[model samples]
Target chain A: MLYIHHSICISPQFTFPEVNLEELVRSTDHKLYAKLIVNPDIPPAMLRRMGKAVKLAVSASGPLLKQYQNLEGIIVGTANGGMEDCIKFLNQIIQYEEGVLTPTNFVQSTPNAIAAQIGFLSKNKGYNITHVHRGLAFENALLDAFMQLDDNPGHTYLVAGIDEISDYNFNIEYLCGYIKKEPVDNVHLYESNTHGSIAGEGVAAFVVNNNQKGAFSCVKALKMLHSTDKDEVEQAFKQFLSENLSDNKTVDLLLSGENGDSRYLDYYRLMEAAVPGAAIGRYKHLSGEYQTSSAFAVWLADYVLRQQQIPELIVKQHSGGNTIRNIVLYTNYQGLQHSFILLSKS
Target chain B: MKVFVTGMGIITSIGDSVESNRKALMEGCCGIGMLKGFSTRYAETLLFGEVKFTNEELRNMAGVNERGVSRTSLLALHAFKQAVSSASLSHEVISDSKTALIVGNTVGGMCLTDELYKDANQRDTGSEYVASYDCGSVGIFLQQKFGMKGIINTINTACSSSANAIMYGTRLIRKGYAKRVIVGGTDSLAKFTINGFNSLHILSSAHCSPFDANRSGLNLGEGAAFLVLESEEVRDNKKVLAEVKGYANTNDAYHPSTLSDTGDGPLLAMTKALEQAGLAPADIDFVNTHGTATENNDEVESRAMISLFNNKVPAFASTKSNVGHTLGASGAVEAVYCILNLLHQEVYPSLNFNAPIAGTGLIPVREYSKAPLDHIMSNSFGFGGNCSSLIFSRV
Candidate 1:
């Protein structure tokens, strides 16, 4: 089993070093951007050059690298990586019309910049990779780390997921009907009878290892699918549960990716029906909606499994579960990339 | 649990098919020249290895009639069709739940940089290309087109993207997650990359001469390549192209855009790959060097090669000299060339080399010749210090 030793998240809520997500920070703006206060420990020289995504990723994983000695690998996932820089570079191109362009923005625009930054800072010479498959990005990164752990049980791995919102991207997505037309309180996000969800972004990182010494949670199984059919999703969920979960106990908490988009409500409804006895919880309202928001969901699941307390603000429906043991996290992006991550108490 | 290559496909400036690429390699034909397909201010100033086709022509060639499909996805579909057909994978087999698709792409729909800029500016109710901007869009398009039901992912580690994809796919098969995997990478020339490389002052004014003392810089290229990898259990009656003996990936952890002078990342990757294959450095018959023609890359790679091979380097050449640097697709394209080298028992020469680097004193194969080959290694190092090496052996 792969154990999550450290989990760090820079979400909209106050979920950084510890889980203090009881208070809800409602946003009046259409985009509920992450409130990631910069870590002062980073050098000013390096901090000035990093984009928001790279900053969040490096800050979240830096402390863990210092705490641990032998990190054998670094894997990261980002759907629309370094969009701010990409947009900046594109604007320079348009302004200059293919003339002299700045290289800094272009250098930071690639998707693997986060992983590379982490590796550079840690001075780690090991297996390093990056995944960018929309919502499945985080899951794919976790799966890659799990496979690495399966190969060498003694090595530690740093896995992270990061994405940042840019004004250009937000405006384009808004025009594409991916974001809500008007601002609404994020606390009441699910009650809005709208076709689109709010836009948000953040970064999350986890230090995973095979040893369960100080692990917060143990990952049981992770599965990803690319399908839009409801029946196929349900069937895959059933198969996944049967293969990973024990016959005696069912899922304790069902963390669903319900981003208040009516088009995808049926997926969450199916997930709710699939896990009848589990307490249903939603995280998109707190974190808003992003491509790799499932990383936040995983971080939240780790918190619940370790702390044994579900935040009342995120609880959609309670099934009288005082002691949380097994949690099933389900997420899908625009009906394209679907993933399921099963976590349990260590 | 051995991973075997069942099929291979590639589309480069030198050729559109594997056979054509092989023929061009044997003849030492250089594809780098003045850009003709796209118009830019640097069109005359800098050299590029652009595929000799327009966007519309590529769309028609790939049989993709859909509007707003990026050139990257078109090239991917074209090469993917070839790979699957060569593998004799039926539609039913390709769409099987046990089949997976992993692609590496650095430039996605951004190839339409002007269109994206206009769309973002006007917000013109968004266009078909709006959703295709991300790196994952290429894989999503392919997955939708082929009705792929298994795991679909995209890796974007710059030039090493496809090499890591191939490595990840092989690991998935070895771990029993997938029975068969279609792994490769695609990248198309765009103003975004051209200006990016140019701004970095790494674009060559002339055709790049890799490993040469006076090598100026690299000529940007565009293309796609795919290889169908299957586990030993699924290799029943399938024609094996080559055996994926070993692979490894390592980060330099020293610099973001350049490698250390010691070439630690490349050395580790080569050593680990050889270790995984249960072979020593001497077992490798030839080496497909990254050889981006940049000063740092050529020198560092030469140092790494000398250190790893213990001063007894094997016959090697950088196909980049012929095809230019294909960025994300370079790794897979070079891997296909390596397979061809093993299959045909031939060594393709590195083009335009007058003198070796000052200290390393390394000389690459200067002429194409037939040689008895058993195992060959391909190296792909990218931005962010991502270095990957793959070794393919005779089956």
Candidate 2:
């Protein structure tokens, strides 16, 4: 099991900086942009050069990285890594016909930039890596952290999941109809029965280690599956729950990543069926749908595990978290990637 | 549990099959030349290690009728099929839940970013290119094609990507997560990368010269390489090419695009790999250095070698001198090259070297020679200070 020391998330509803998410916020447009919370400690000069994802990524985990000086590593999972900067450079290339250009955008364009920036800022110079496997990105990063921590007991590591939407992102995703073109009332996302979900972006950073001292909870097990069939997903989730859970422990809170995308709600229904009578919850409404939106669900798992109540979540707490002990997060992205994380109150 | 390389395949500017590439390396042939397989203004000015086949030609060879598949995935599919066939693995075995697939890539469908941009800019009903842009798209395509149900992942640590992919595959087998794992990487010449490297001014005007005193820059190459890694327990009578003895990944964290002058990351990675292998530096017979031929890489790498080898560096060379720097694919390419050398008891020569650096004065192998080799160390370092080293020992 991996211990979660600090889990911080920055999203549109302001999940971080210890804000009280009393009333969930909704985006007037289909795209839900994150309000960046910059770190004052980072020099303005350095911060100016970082893209939105990089800036918020470092800010979300900056404190934990600083507190734990000798970290084993920083691993990040991202789908669209600074594509805004990359597209800007490509545009420069086209506009200049390969004549005039600056190297800033190109340097920040690589997907590892987020993890590397954290190391550059902390100057730890340890193992830094990035995984860009679409929906499974965060789960892979968490697995890396878990495996690393499991290998070396008591070692601390920083793991994060980040994806940001650019002004052009929604339009591009809209062309494929992967994102809804109409303005989405994230509050009433399921009511529209639209063909696609809203475009959203956020970053969640966690300090995971082998030590459980002062930790919020423990990541008991993590399982990921890639499938195109709803029945397969249902069976895989049932198998995952049975295999990962010890002592036949029952789930107290189960968060379903139902984004209300018409094409994918059936898979979500199947997932819900896998765990009957569990205290069901929904998060994509608050964070919208993105590649690593599962990270948002993880942060919520920690929140509900500690707060003893859901924070304005959809369905308004299905059964109970009054004495919640096991929080199972089952997230499916685009009906192809499925993940289950068993979080326990250690 | 030891990880053994049961089968491997590669497609590069040098050649596509193992034997052809071995012949080129033995003859000290250089594949860096005018770019081909695409329309780019750089075709007239810059050099690239582009494979001989065009995208359509590769798709036809791989029998992939899927629309909008990028050249990156095509090259990947080409190498992947060869590796699986060479391993004598059945379709059922490859599709089993005990088999894992991992691909390391920095360039995904962005090789077709031109089409992606056209689709995005025009917002004309979505193009097939949209479905191919994700970094995971390549692995997803392979999984769907083979029905692979095990762990599937992609690593994008710039140049060290495939080395990390190989490392992750080894870990999966060692941890019993899979009986066998296919790990490698792919990249194709893209206008996006050409312009990106051009803006950085790191594209060499001529063929790259590694460890040379005045090495200019890197020649961006395009290709793919894949290796079927199996646990010793599940070798299934397959010929053992080599044993994955040790590996390590470390970050310099000193700069975004440059390695530290001290070569701290490479030094640590090499040291850790040797420790894991339980082999001393002297046990290694040859070192396939990262040797991107950039002003920074050769110097930092040389410094690291001197420190690790205690001034008695092993016979070192950069096969990148033959295939040019294949970016994300270089690690696995060089690993397979090392396995070939280990299997043949020989070493390939580095091309275009006249003088040594001022202080290091370390020169790479200048000629092909038949030397009894037991272990080979392959190094791959990338942007963002990602450094990885793999140790391959004769089984």
Candidate 3:
């Protein structure tokens, strides 16, 4: 029952500086990369110390945090924490005989270094936990915050998720066949018949608490499944909806993790069919794919809850947004580890 | 929501199992010695509190046939197996339903990274080296070996990794996420960590004497420990060793390498943990301080303890002097030390403390003392200004 007091996202999509996302999507000039962050100043010393992901996470956390006085806990999630730093460290260590290795890069290569940095920058001396569970990384941290709020009320938790893609990342995904070969319009990602989704990077943060501050919807329930099939995923979705809703009715919005990957299309397709009356929306096209992209879906949910409007480009059916009281977000990594986070207007 | 510790296992330089570790602590035996586990290029100046077992011995005890397991994972598996055995949990039970494993290793498989590096570059490198360097492989191997389905997470928050893991385990039980969980951390000495600490000029040549006025720095050690936490519903004949009364994590958010000069983060974390445990600082009988013997760490931590206790601190000691600073495993390792203290009713000495600090006027207990200790507090602070404190009480 934690409330989302403030939230921010720095992704490839059009998210920052604009209150409405539809406007950003319309103003996009290119389609290859989609980082949503606005223009930011990068200090020279920071550039020497931080990679793109760390920079993005630190910036987002800094702005979104309002009550820095008694910041109770910090929970960070990343599919690959500091892979770029790790690559730099590894290449340097192997290239040079430990003589020219930069301790700065090597020190910040650990996954929790970003959280540590956030702690330092914010002067937050509260509980800090870092999670790296592939796709469920962000969801796990979010759930941890939810549980923390439930057990100890009136405390604010900083929940952040970040992941970045480098040439090494593209190489690994290229080897794993997760990168797209053919050019596809992100605006029309669902129309594609291809299997792989485009790779992207971003960081998102939320100041959440048990008390509903009315700026965002309250998260009703969250569930993570390992090795979920299409049928079982649909059944679980229905069970989740039933657990929350007294009326056997459709939700107002259904946010999805439909990356261009064909193996996982059936999961979203099942979701689309299950929620007949809801306005279905897919975001991986605008943001691309990372371990914690579901966090972007959360940002989207917050936006929809606040603005009470859905962009036509995002509307799959456009049937039930006049009374958009509920938004159910479904996210997973390659359809293996799935998460369901349900939120409603406060 | 009651979280009970049903079983505990450890593999430190002092011993290989919980019983042996307890006996050693009671007998006032120290395990810090000259480094012998791995060959070091900078050998003359380095000392460590290293376990005597080879990787093969740990792997054999852990029942892992795969050679891809890293030395850190080997230590983790060994301790995890011992925990299961100590708790009397059958393999069938673990394989049947959602048993989760929460491993907190700051440097996951750095030892493997060392091997991978030399094998690739040096022609004279040994042919026997074969292990994966990926950080997630440790958790993946444990999950595969044990056949667990519940939430498997790897926390990499430096020194507080395993303390956060135990905190997560308790939260999982209270949240009804899992009926049982194996929570702990493991770290092995590697060239990267050693060189990193050496570059920082914080590696002590001799055995570490934490909180000593003349202590220079800490001697790095390697080990692992895991505790089986059972939800109140599942506790059968398994006697509760101690209850995870409360825990809190706080970030200094001050500096990457240094804590705040005021020690506010550690103080806040300890206060929150005490509040969660429904106790005051006066209720804590003993504290397992994160006295890494480094000048900055000891002085700042002593200042924080004073602030928390309002000038009357509990009888606390730094066990790092005995086992060296185990890094990521230190928090969890010391936690087991706290539980051992609670059960044994005696406080271990801080070892090698001769004088008080110039400003804080704080002195740790120099020798073991017999006392009716019921509750113990343990602190672990890390590089990112991450500080965590846990309160464990005897059942």
Candidate 4:
């Protein structure tokens, strides 16, 4: 019932809105920073006060919100929200020795600030929420929207996953071995047995509803898991696929987030073995890795299904089939956080 | 499908357990005073609803030996264990795939903003707390503790965070994704929030007076509360504290941090919740309100109540007057308090209130008294115009 009528993303890959998708650019700065996309409608004063994450989220979802007025709700997901503004406020507190300070940065520092700003912009005023969990944040938010759609038929929702890279989060993640020790060629992401990934910023948004008119793709199922045990995961994966697929057959494509982390290669191998006949595709190499990188994979699923062809750059091991229909995107983080999403060509 | 509250646990500035909090409520004792648990520049200048437990002590209470986790997680664990034990839920039952955990929190490990600041600026390997900096750390910490396999997520919509968590929990059960859910929220008083609220100029130097004509602002507090809610089919002959009758979440969409002057969001939330419960304003016996005592909140909430009840506003009180506005934890915490009202057929008085606000002229219950109650409403409105209301009725 969850159909994507319109979708767009702002990432290191490109700003794909009303415009066409662009070729991927590999990460060279150890971090793939999103190219800041600006909207002319946003007042310059408001833009001046917005933090990096707020700006990215508004720029990505604002157009959709403006085009389609009075959407029922807005659900946003983020791992580290407004770390840039938060750090600014913290630095001020330290610099001023707990003296008088401005509230703008602190007001915009909460994880829900992105959704709040969007709420102010759209003024729809129905139901609004933000999910701040790490790996499953987007899935949770999407499920909330789907739950609403199921409750009230034919309701439109704006769902998004956003994360902005800042010096604070990037440096800490780099030191913690989640990011590559040094800048590596993202083009050769999986070629070497490296221990870490190249981090990136991403905001993927969709205008979704149950009406299905002019819809490009549909998300049939979503399952989140916390266990890393192979048997448990395999069993869950089998159950997820069997329950979601009408034909109970192999999916057309499996766009996985195997972000070239050598430590979790075995987990990816286990995943590939679970689905034998599916065409394997990879996206983290193009978009870089993040907490909600699976969002980008979902966005790509809609595109591949609409175009009925897989982009060769993203194809790791392509099947001979030319027509793409069912896509199952699997995303894993440190082998601890994992999710499976079943998306179908409309 | 009826969602029944099977068990509850709470740790607030007033008390640590259900019985203790109930006793404090009966005595009309307030939990807000000078800050003690966490130190800040406003420590002596402003009042807070501190939980009266140090991090090390809370760790001991929670039976946690981990250091990387924040105080927020420890408070959550303290309440979570109590809820599980009170419900007599075994480890096997809790770890079942049908049992879900949906928690709401605001200041996760950021309560340790100082430590995070140090770790982020480091040149060498990051501290162990790097992974725990985000809001997910609290839920992830409790998830690992129980080995919970069901849908686990953290919600953060500012002050109404946990009320939305409870509402979402009901949706999951209705959708058949879960049979039972442990839903609640936890927030620790931290320099991060204190400074944040202080910067907003909403932190009251004196005690907050809900519904008072000369009310100032809110006192930032710290606490945690949780409810173990189960579908009726899973009742299995368990004692039901109350039935979750109705709930609604709405946004004013007028501003980021302030509710509109007309109480548009509050009115919608309360009206919709009553509609879902299939009740009228007259059916509500009492209301645990989200009266933050700020100039905007008190007047707006009062106006909303007057409009919804047709000027015969039900007996209402803000628990924030007892425990300073707990922010993210207030929704779930006040929910536990409302369940208390339902169970005992009594109402708690607002701690600090005198005359009603000038325009609205709404007066809160000033004395803890026994009342025949059927349905009790709890309201939680947060920053970002996120407002939610939940109703609990006699089973």
What's the lDDT for all of these models?
0.90, 0.86, 0.78, 0.87
Residue runs of model 3 more than 4 Å from their true location after superposition = A19-48, A66-71, A100-102, A169-196, A228-235, A269-273, A276-279, A312-322, B27-40, B66-68, B91-100, B114-136, B352-356, B360-363
Considering only chain A, what is the TM-score of each predicted structure? 0.97, 0.96, 0.92, 0.96
Question: Interface RMSD of candidate 3?
Answer: 5.2
Give candidate 3's error at residue A171 in angstroms. Answer: 3.9
Which of the predicted structures, 1 or 3, would earn the higher TM-score when compared with the native? 1
Between candidates 3 and 4, the lDDT winner: 4
Chain B of candidate 1 vs. true chain B, TM:
0.99
lDDT of 4 at B215: 89
Q: Which stretches in model 2 have alpha-carbon errors above 4 Å?
A: A246-248
Residue A313's lDDT within candidate 3 is 57
- Show where candidate 4 strays beyond 4 Å: A18-22
Ranking by lDDT: 1, 4, 2, 3
DockQ pick, better of 1 and 4:
1
> B1-395 in candidate 2: lDDT tens per residue?
89999999999999988889999999999888997677777886888998999887898899998787888999999899989988988999998889999999988888886676776566657778877876788998999899888889999999999999999899888877789999999988888888878778888988899999988888989899999999988897789999999999999989999999999999999999999899999999999999989999999999999999999999999998899888989998998899999999999999999999999999999999999999899999988899999999998
- Please give the distance, in angstroms, between residue B385's alpha carbon in candidate 1 and its true position after superposition: 0.8
Across B1-395, the per-residue lDDT of candidate 3 in tens digits comes to 78999888899988998888877776667888777766665455777888878887877776777656788888888788888888887887665445677888866656765555554343332334332354555676677687665777777778888888899888898888888888898898876777677767788887777777788888888899999999888888779989999998888877777777898778888998999899988999988999999989999999999989989998999988888888878887998899888887888877878888888888888777788887888998888888888999988
Model 4 pairs in collision: none
Give the CA lDDT, 0 to 100, for residue A253 in model 4.
91
